[model samples]
Target: MLQIEDVLRDRGSRYAVSGGAVQGRAGADAFVAELKRVKKFAKATHNTWACVFSDLGPVKADDGEAGAGAVILKMLEREGLYDHIVVVTRWYGGVHLGGDRFAHVVTAVRAYFAALHSAQSR
Candidate 1:
């Protein structure tokens, strides 16, 4: 059986939008666009994103990222690991992430996600 929590766990995978002084709308748009681009370039069949804002709905998800993508981002937010962050999950068709590769992918996106979040926060 697959626990929802297990599926949601960040596992250190993240992508963020940060820096510069941009309004909520612009910031959100930028992050969303970037996520879409990444997904397209990765040739991923699925791409999902979630954004949390104090004054807004707090949580929003894009079905494109698939259920797992949305769930994983939510899990990370719940853990208080990030704010104003967006994460994208790519399911490689042939290649597989057994060890370091998996970690690398997650870390790379996490860093970018953090950066995006940081940028908007400013």
Candidate 2:
């Protein structure tokens, strides 16, 4: 786990992105287990998540965020990250963010990737 947490502020919306690396490939059940392991995100309005494993390929859930899973999946594909799951928690600030929401998701995943790289370096 990389212990990544970042808050993205855009268009009056606050997105808290966090994630962990599972060390090995994880399937859908493992992804759900990971979500349950993160107690902090359980009560969030939306726990949008995505995970990719070398063998399992990729799987994601928008958690009602709509198209968020695809955004995360694209990032993972670009980075070539495997056996990792990222969760973005959103707190709506009473404003609509539109496409900016995807940007926030990217911001969150970027933070996670940075942390993951740092951890691997160490």
Candidate 3:
């Protein structure tokens, strides 16, 4: 099965940016900027990204790393942060973090959004 280790290798962070339309050319630009910022912060060499932007809603995922990117994107969607954005960045650590460990990292990043959602809901 596909795993995180196959995608991410080390330190990473996920951030969401809201307050703007997440579709069309403008949305794509914003999303790219967010992706760059997150990648810069993580000092990641590679980045996979995906987005769903439309009148229907905003959704996206990176297909570069296949399953790994898809999984991360799904987690972001579950956070329910609409009219917003999410980017997952990773910095290679040289040592393999394994599939389980990698998934944990993705989960941890998603948890940040969960916390944000919880705080906003209150």
Overall lDDT per candidate, in order of appearance: 0.44, 0.75, 0.47
TM-score of each: 0.43, 0.80, 0.54
For model 2 the local lDDT of residue 14 reads: 68
The sequence of per-residue lDDT tens digits that candidate 1 reaches over residues 1-122 is 00011122233432322212223655766765554564442454334545555455345454453354455455456645433545444444444334543343345445554554565599
| Prediction 2 TM-score vs. true | 0.80
Which one wins by lDDT: 1 or 2? 2
lDDT tens digits, residue span 44-83, model 3: 5435444444454545545343455566556657655454
Q: Per-residue lDDT tens digits of candidate 2, residues 74-100? A: 998899877777777787778888888
- Regions of model 3 farther than 4 Å from truth: 1-21, 34-39, 54-64, 77-81
C-alpha displacement of 44 in model 3, angstroms? Answer: 1.3
Q: How many angstroms is residue 15 displaced in model 3 relative to the true structure, after the best TM-score fit? A: 11
What C-alpha lDDT does candidate 1 achieve relative to the native structure?
0.44
Q: CA lDDT of 36 in candidate 2? A: 57
Q: Count residue pairs with overlapping backbones in model 3.
A: 10
Residue 106 lDDT, candidate 3, scale 0-100: 68
Worst 10-residue lDDT window for candidate 1 reads 1-10
Candidate 2 runs further than 4 Å off: 23-40
